[model samples]
Target: MLPSAIVSMTEFPLNSNGKIDRKALPAPEFTMERCDKVAYVAPQSPAHITTCEILASLLGVDKVGLDDNFFVLGGHSILAMKAIMAIKQAIGIDINIVNLFEAQSVRELCVLVDAELLRKQLEETEEFEEEGVF
Candidate 1:
């Protein structure tokens, strides 16, 4: 999951001794757009369903929609890596971390997963053909 809100600090908070002060740091503000008009859209395929389930579980949400923004839902970089690993184990596809950052929604991630799966299948087929195993 990505950060929903980012706080920029001009200088590090320091204590009287000139040490970094954790307590003096300002709290980050997190704001997400809430819309009552937005309807929940179900997963369209097995991959989509799996992706949603993984995200929901990782993000500790009751349910995740295809259009839901991961960062807005409290996703962070560490959780993103965890989600990627879970996705790889569940779907047998390696998802690049950068790709995950770029595609922050379940729908977009599913598309990347599908494309990766297709590429893997093609590669396997090509290898098999070269070896005359099929």
Candidate 2:
């Protein structure tokens, strides 16, 4: 969705001989749209909140706020690579590193983490059953 707040310059004042004037006018500026309405959004999800807390405390951000954007909070590819390694060591699951950037928001990242966790659990259970260990 395009932001409607941005405005473009219309025209530059012309000099007496129909030449463009550079010094006679003030600096041109783009107008920004102002909106007075505030909208309500749902509360932060449990998993997302948890991830936010972890990322904030570990990555050194302001605080563990779920609404915070990962990149805006100062996360990058190197951090994401480190995150994947940490996640695998902590959760015992292999996850693709690219998912971190694609799933930019904490909520989306939580979903991917949950899915990977469940997949690993199921695989372990299946392995146990295959060995007839119940």
Highest-scoring model, TM-score? 1
Mind giving the per-residue lDDT tens digits that candidate 2 earns over 4-41? 23435577678999887867656545331121121212
Model 2 residue 65 CA deviation (Å) reads 3.3
Best by lDDT: 1
CA RMSD of each candidate after superposition: 4.9, 7.9
Worst lDDT window (10 residues) for model 1?
30-39
Q: Candidates' TM-scores?
A: 0.72, 0.58
What's the CA error at residue 12 for candidate 2, in Å? 23
Cα-based lDDT for every prediction: 0.83, 0.62
